[model samples]
Target: AQSVTQPDARVTVSEGASLQLRCKYSYSGTPYLFWYVQYPRQGLQLLLKYYSGDPVVQGVNGFEAEFSKSNSSFHLRKASVHWSDSAVYFCVLSGNNYAQGLTFGLGTRVSVFP
Candidate 1:
């Protein structure tokens, strides 16, 4: 079984400041890590994914995440955030070939202040 834990329920960042969101996962085989952003009343958009190559994966809107197999963590980071970046971030793990279900974290609501 695959699972994810997002420690923070919410994060507030100032406009033009950097941000990092924490995520941890538990899986047996190779885990497919992903970061998804969801705006109010909108569906989740794929930020990035880590399957085979590179430990550091880049995503849209200057967002990036580092996959650490040792720590079992994949934390999202942004050099500078904008007010428009305010939204809910979710860490997800895709189940292996059988079900391929997505296990999502509770969520972290990011409030960007200007």
Candidate 2:
């Protein structure tokens, strides 16, 4: 019954510009949310996560996201993006155990222009 949807298939942004990636989820109970970044030929790295407490969470490389219970959304934001930030961003969700594996969105490919 839990699922994720990333509306945008691809996003193009200029270097030093702000960026926002949309994510929406469907879950009945408490959900563990995550955003991962994967560079070319690289493994997925956790950018940020929202479990409980603060709705806003900061992540590596100046990235952050806010969780909204009402909208069922958790959108990633960056004040400034770099060319190196060009990678595939995936919005993921896990109910309890990481061992349970992950349910991921279609993924959003971010392209940072020079």
Candidate 3:
């Protein structure tokens, strides 16, 4: 079984500032990792994902994430954030079995202030 943990429940950052959201995972084997964002009254949208190959994956809107198998972490990063970036970010882990579905973190609410 795979599980994800997001320590920060909420994160605040000033507009144009850099932001990083921490994510930790526990799994027996190599797993697929994903980052998703949910806007107000909207469904979750995929930001980026890592399955194999390069550890770094690019996402929408200048967002990117680096996957570290040794550290068991996949953290999301943004060089400069905007007020429109405010949303709930979720870290998801998927096991080898596709039918098992994905395990999601509690989510980190990001608030970008002007």
Candidate 4:
């Protein structure tokens, strides 16, 4: 089975500042990884995903994520953040195939101060 863990529960940063959210996943075999974000009163949206090939994948709204097998991590990063970026980010792990069930982390709440 695959599992995800987001170390930080909440992160506060000033608007326009660079931000990075940590995500750790545990899975023995190859797994499908994804980063999802949820805004206030909205459903979760896919940010980026890593399946094979490239270790880095670009996402919407200038967001990107890097997958590391050795470290068992898939961290999300944004060079500059906006107040609109404030939301709850989740690290999701689907098993070896996408059809399998998905396991999500507790999620990290990001707040951007203006």
In order, what lDDT does every prediction score?
Answer: 0.93, 0.95, 0.97, 0.94
Of candidates 3 and 1, the better by TM-score = 3
Candidate 3 regions with alpha-carbon error over 4 angstroms: none
Write candidate 3's Cα lDDT for 1-114 as tens digits. 778999999999999999999999999998899999999999999999999999999999999999999999999999999999999999999998888799999999999999
Candidate 4 colliding pairs, count: 0
Best TM-score among the predictions, by candidate number: 3
Q: Per-prediction TM-score, please?
A: 0.96, 0.95, 0.97, 0.95
- Ranking under TM-score, best-scoring first? 3, 1, 2, 4
lDDT of 1 by residue, 2-97 (tens): 789999998998999999999999998888889999999999999999997889999998999999999999999999999999999999998676
**Model 1 CA deviation exceeding 4 Å by range:** none
Best by lDDT: 3
RMSD of 3: 0.7
lDDT of 4 by residue, 24-95 (tens): 999989888999999999999999889999899999999999999999999999999999999999999988
Give the residue spans of candidate 4 off by over 4 A: 97-100
Model 1 Cα shift for residue 11 (angstroms):
0.5
Q: Record all residue pairs in model 1 with backbone atoms less than 3 Å apart, i.e. clashing.
A: none
